[model samples]
Target chain A: MYKGARVETIVSISWETLLDGVKKGNVRSLARIITLVENREPGWKDAMKSLYPLGGKAKIVGITGSPGAGKSTLTNAVARDFVARGYTVGIIAVDPSSPFSGGALLGDRLRMRDVVTLPEIFIRSMATRGALGGLCQGARDIARILDAFGKDVVIIETVGVGQDEVEVVKAADLVMVVCVPGQGDGIQALKAGIMEIADLYVVNKADREGADEVVADIGGMLDISDNGGRPQPPVIKTSALANQGITELVDALVQGFESGRNADSWQAQRVKEEILTLVETEILDYLRENWERTGDLDKAVEGILEKQTDPYSVVDSLLPLIREASRSKETT
Target chain B: MNNKKIRVLIAKPGLDGHERGARIIAYGLRDAGFEVIYTGLRQSPEQIVSAALQEDVDVIGLSILSGAHLSLTKKVVDQLKSNDAEDILLVVGGVVPEQDVASLKEMGVAGVFTAGTSVSQVAQFISEQVNA
Candidate 1:
C-alpha cells in the first residue's frame, strides 16, 4: 500500500512481515522493505539485526565513474550478463539530490531500460539525499536488504563522480572505478585518492577516438604506482554501447570476487567499522529525535541563524545529553 | 522522526517522442522537493507497473501525449489493480482531452493535468492526494 509522504499514521509494515517477504523473494515486499529501511523507520535497527544474519552471501559490487563514463549502461550490461549466467541480481543506482530542494531526478534507469523487466533482475533508483560522499548509509542498508533477499549479486552504482569520492570502497567487496576515453590523460584515474580505491579500472567507450591512449596511460600509471607488491588493478576496456568486452570484464569480476572479502583480519576490520558507524548513526538519530521532539533542535538552529551561537557551541551543548544517555546505558 | 521524502515515478507510455513535458515535470518535482524516478520514453504498462513495484513509489505520474490516454491509462490502471497496487496514487499528464478526463477518473486515475496545469499545482495535488 502507498503511504503518503506526510502520512501521520504509523507505517503499517512491520519488520517481521518485511523480513518474511524478503526471505520469500517477493519483489514488492523487497521494494517496500527497502523503502522502510532507506527511510530509517523506527525499529529499523532491530529489523536489520534480524536481516543481517541472512546476508553475507551476495557478492556486492560497487560501480562508480564520471558522469558520462557509462556507469549505468555498463551496470546494465554487467547485470544482464550475471542474470544470463543464472544469478539473481539487484541494483541500487544512486543519483544526486538537489541541494536546494532535497529532490532528485534519478535517471540512471534511463540507461538501464533493457534490464528493467527481467524477473531475475531488480533495479532500485536511489538519491544520494545530500550525502556528501555521493553514497549514503541508506544505500548500504538497501544493499543488505537485497542481500537478504537472496540475490546472488548486488551492484551499487553511484552517481557520476569526480576525484575523491571513495565511499564505495567501504561498501563493496570489490570496487570498479570506471573511466572513459577522452576524459583527459588517464592519470586522473591514478590520482592520489581515487586510484587507491579501485580494485579494477574500466576504460569504457573504448570505441571512441582516444581509447588506446587512455588504456596505455592507465597501464603506465599503474606501473608507476606499484607499491608494496600489491596486485596492480586491472584496466579493462569496454564499449557498453555496443555491448563489447563485457564478458572479459565479467570474467575478471568472477576472478576478483573469488578471492573473497573474508580475510580474517580484514573481515574483523570491516565489522569494527560497521559497528562504529552504526553506533554513531544511532547516537545522532537518538539525539536528533529527542531534541526535535523537545523543540531544542529548532531552537539551536534558530540560535545559530540568529548569531546567538555557532555549530561548535551547539555540539558542546548537545554533549551533556549524550553523556547522560551513556550513563543511563552503562547503568542499564 | 517521521522525516520522509515522497518518491514519484514519472513515466512516458506508448510511442510519444515528446519528452519536453515529462522532463519539465521531472525537474519541477525535484525542485519541489520530491524524489522523482524518471523511466524514459516508450514504457509499456507492464514496464511502468514493474518500475513502480521495484521503486515502491508513492505515486506514478504518466505523461502520455500520444492521444491514446484512455486506452493506455486503462491498461496501466488495470495492471496496477491486478498487481494489488491500487493504493499507489496514479496521475496522468499530457494532452489528455477534457472529455476523456471523467472516464479516466472513473477508471481510478487520481488526477489529470492538461496543457495548462502548473508544476506547483501538480506538486500540491500529489502532496494532498498522497498524504491524505
Candidate 2:
C-alpha cells in the first residue's frame, strides 16, 4: 500500500519521516533525498528549508585538474589519510551528465576502494544533470547535509576545472589543483581556467618521465604570477599511484584550511554565491510550476524555437505578465 | 526478444575518480543493447539521484572503488526511500570485499557485483530485476 501511494502524497509525508532516516545516518535515505533535491522535485524546497538550519558544520575542500591528472587518486589517498587520523570525511565527485538522456556513467568512486568502507566516511558521485554547473550546487547541498550529519571534512573533487568546475571549486574552503607528468596540454589548460584558483598544486605520477620539467614549468608560471597577496600557493609533488606524498598532501590540506588563509574570503564568496543560486533556483521553480498554467512562457518557447520572437522580446512580454499576475493575486 | 533499451545510470560516489572501469562498463552496457548514461567521472549522491529520477531509469548502478561504499550507498538508499523512489532497483559493482556484501545487501542494495564479475552477469541481473 505504501509503495502504491501517489508521488505527491508520498512526498507529502512528514519531514520527520525523512529526517528520521537522515538522523539515523541512513545512507540510502540521504542519497535519495539528495537525488530528489538535485532533480528539483516538487516540495524539495520545503524539505531543504527544513534541513537548512542544521547545516554549516563541515569543512569543504575542492580538488580539480585536467583529465588523467590523478585527481581521483589524490582524493582517495587524502580521504584515507583523514580517516586514519580518526576524522569523518564526505566526498562529492562531480561528473559530467549525459545531455541526451540526462543519466550518468559515474565510476570515479572505484578509485578509493580501501577507505570507502570506513563508518566515518561518505562518498557520492554526481553528474551535471542537464544543468551546466548544476552539479556544483548539488555538491554544495550534499556537503551541507553531510556537515549537518557530523562529517569533519567534505572533499569536492570536480571533473576537471572547466568553467563550470571552476565555479564549483570556488565553493570550497580550499582548492587543490592536481597535475601530472607527460600531460602536454594540462599545464596550458590549467593556466587557462584552473591555475588561478588552486591553493595547492600537486604533481602526481611523480615517477613518470619529465616530472621534474613539469614541476619546473609550474614553478616558473607561479613565479611570474606570484602577486604576494597571500602566501604563494604551495607546490607539492605526489605520486598517488605509489601512495607517495599522500601524508604531505593531507598535511598541506590541513595547514591550508586551518591556517585560515583560504577560509575567510572563500566562505564569504560561497555564501554570496549560495544565496544567488537559491534565488535562481526559486525563480526557476516558480516558472516551472506556472509554466502550464500561464501558457505564456510555452508560447515564448515555441516562438523562440521557431524563430518567431527574439529572446529579449519574449522576456519583455513575459515580465509584465508575471508582474501583473502577482499584482492581481496580491490585490485579490 | 524485444530490443527495448535498458536505461542505466553509472554513478561514482565520493572522491575516487578512477573512471576506467565505469567507462568500460558504460561502453559494454551500451554495446549490449542498453542505453548507458555515462556521467563522465565524479558525482555526488544528490546528482546521481537526480539523474536516476529524471532519467526514469530502470537501474541505478553505482561503481564505487572507494572504501566509503557503506556510507555512500546508505546515503543513496536514504535519498531514494525519502523520495518514495524505492521502486528503482539499486546495484553496485566495484572493488567491494566479500565481507561487506551482506551488509550492502541489508542496506537495500539489490545486487552487489564486485571485481571479476562478468559484465554479462550484471546485464543479465538487471534484466531479471526489471523484467521480473
Best by DockQ: 1
lDDT of 2 by residue, A1-332 (tens): 21223244435655567667777876656665665666665666677877778777667899988877878778888998998988889888776655564445555655766655566777766666646345667778877777767788999988874688788887788888888877774386576567778888888899888778878888888888864577788888899979998999888888876774454565677678888886565555556567768787788889999989899997776676567555655675
lDDT of 1 by residue, A1-332 (tens): 33342253236656777788788878888888788777767777788889989998988888877778889999999999999899999999988888899999999889998799999999999887764332546677888889998999999998756442466556788889898877667556446477766778899999989988988987887787754555787889999989999999999888878874445355687667666776676667678778978898899999999999999999998889898766766775
Would you list the C-alpha lDDT of every candidate in the order shown? Answer: 0.84, 0.74
> Least lDDT summed over 10 consecutive residues: which range in candidate 2 chain B?
B1-10
Classified by CAPRI criteria, candidate 2 counts as incorrect
Per-residue lDDT tens digits for candidate 2, residues B56-95, read 4667889999888998999999888876677778888888
Q: For candidate 1, what is the interface RMSD?
A: 3.3
Query: What are the TM-scores, per candidate, against the unseen true structure?
Result: 0.92, 0.72
Instruction: Give the worst 10-residue stretch by lDDT in candidate 1 chain A.
Output: A1-10
